[model samples]
Target: MDRFVFAGRTCVITGAASGIGAALALHLARREALLFLVDRDAGGLARVAAQAKAAGARDVATEVVDLADGGDRLDLAAAVEARFGGTDLLINNAGVTLSGSFEQVSMDDYDWLMEINLRAVVRTTKAFLPQLLARPGAHLVNLSSLFGLVAPPRQVAYATSKFAVRGFSEALRHELAGRQVGVTVVHPGGVRTNIATSARLSGPDLDGQQAAAAKAFSEKALTMPPEEAARQIVAAVESRKPRLVISKEAKAGDLLARLIPGHYWNVIARVLPKGL
Candidate 1:
């Protein structure tokens, strides 16, 4: 099959306000893609829309909606369909992080993270699946994470959500085999994003430790630039690659998980930076 093209294609991206999502918006814009950007931060969403327009997007639309809310997800999908007519590409990039061990985290917070990270992706994909089927050569992208590959301490909620994304994307790819639509599940390493700093801390007294760990992880492990990650993702989309793992750290983790599925974390803990 021929590779996917971005120019003039209608692409819907969630979490487009900042980080990898914003960088992706700009990257696709330079390719002249029609963009529908979504995020909860109105101000940041507006800024990205303006930048997307300036970067040469054929057309740009912005939606400020909380993906964790089912009503908002449905409403956003309807609005996108109404305005864009149809979507050629759907990128489920919105995600949140929860810090603390499983016991330290509350069920409410865990559910909240799941709502945005996994449920939102599933719901949005369901909403747009018809459009993707109707359009020839359409594609879907889900942003999983390095945590998706490796299960580590203090990241139970995040790992669960990301692992679910990875599973969903892989299964969907199998189901869509030989179809016009394509699926790509992304496993990005610590690209410098605010997910760490802005992570919701669960335990009451563990705030200081969690905060320090988040800071350390962001500083030491978040080595790749969002722009670079965006470039790699766009390239993966063009090739219709089923899986794209970004950054050396993520790649290493993926390999380790496969090599020692029973105890990868044993090695990971030893090599991982302190406080993380």
Candidate 2:
């Protein structure tokens, strides 16, 4: 498939304040795409908007909407409809991570992460589907994680949410193929995001060691740059690829999952770093 042109295309990206979302906004702006950026962090959103404008975005709109709330997501969609009529691309990039085993993580933390990662994706996508359908050559991108493909020791809540996203993206892709809309499920390995520092650590070792370990794991194992991940995501959307794995580690994990199926835990336990 030919690369889909972003010039004059309307793109809405949730969680546009930082990390992969911010990088995607900048990259898409450079491509001359009209951008609607949304995030709960008003300050971070402003900074990204300024950078996007400076990067050559002709039309940029930003909103401080928390996707965790269904009402906020609907309002965001209304705002998009009011400003640009509709969007050609919807990137579901906002998500949170919880650090701990299933037993260690609290039910409240699990619910909170699930609300942001899975429920928000569903709500936001549903809110924008009408607009996407009206536009020609629309694309949907959902961000899953490498953990989604292969579960490790910790991160039970995060993995569960990502696994759900992966399933949703797959089913939606098949359902939308005949409707002129494409879906791409992204599995990013690490990509230097603040999710580590901001993650809720819930273990007995919460004296700060768990948080530090997560940061270290992200820095060492998840080394892909956010900008690079954004570029690849855009490319995948353009090419209409069904699945896009961002890093070498992510690719390896996917392969391992496919080969091992029900036994990847054993392999991962042996291969993963001792501290993590």
Candidate 3:
């Protein structure tokens, strides 16, 4: 297939209020794509929509909806359909992180994370699939994580959700092949984002050590700018790349996982920065 074009194409992106999602909205806006941006932060979404319009988006729409809620997701899909009639690109970028070991995190917390991260991705895809199928060369992008490629200690819940996303995207890619819909699953390393500071701590850490560790990890490991990550993602989408792993750290993790599927964590743990 030829390179996917964004000009005048209707695109829907979740979590467009901040981080990589915000960056993506700007990039696509510059490409003159019609934009539908969704996030729970009404203020942030409005800001992005204004910027997108100024950046040369052919059209811009904003929706403030909590992706974790099925009703919200449904309403978002309906609004997109009503406004744009259909969508050419659907990027499921909304996600949250939880910090704790399996024993420390409660089931409620785990479920909440899954609802926004994995379940929402699946539901959103299902909701927009008809439109994507109708549009030639349509694409789907799912934001997984480096942890999705390799599991580690204390990240049981997060790793589970990301791995599930990776698996779901891969399987759906196969199913959609020869049907014109392209799927791209992204595993980003530590792009500078609020995800770290905003991550929920499952259980009480009386000494406040867990919170401190999260801060340290955010400062030390989140090296890539969100703009750079967004640039790579947009390029991959244009090229119809099926899988993208951003950052040197993510590449190394992917390599290690392939080489030592069972014991990569032993080596990773040693090299991982302290306090995380």
* Ranking of predictions according to lDDT: 3, 1, 2
Q: Which residue pairs collide, candidate 3?
A: none
Q: Estimate TM-scores for all models.
A: 0.97, 0.95, 0.97
User: Model 1, range 55-90, lDDT digits (tens) per residue?
Assistant: 999999998889888753566667777888889999
Off by over 4 Å in 2: 1-3, 203-206
**How far out, in Å, is residue 161 in model 3?**
0.4
Lowest summed lDDT over 10 consecutive residues: which window, candidate 3?
A: 68-77
Error of 2 at 104 (Å): 1.9
Candidate 2 has its poorest 10 consecutive residues by lDDT at 66-75
lDDT of 3 by residue, 37-97 (tens): 9999999999999999999999999988887775535667778889988899999999998
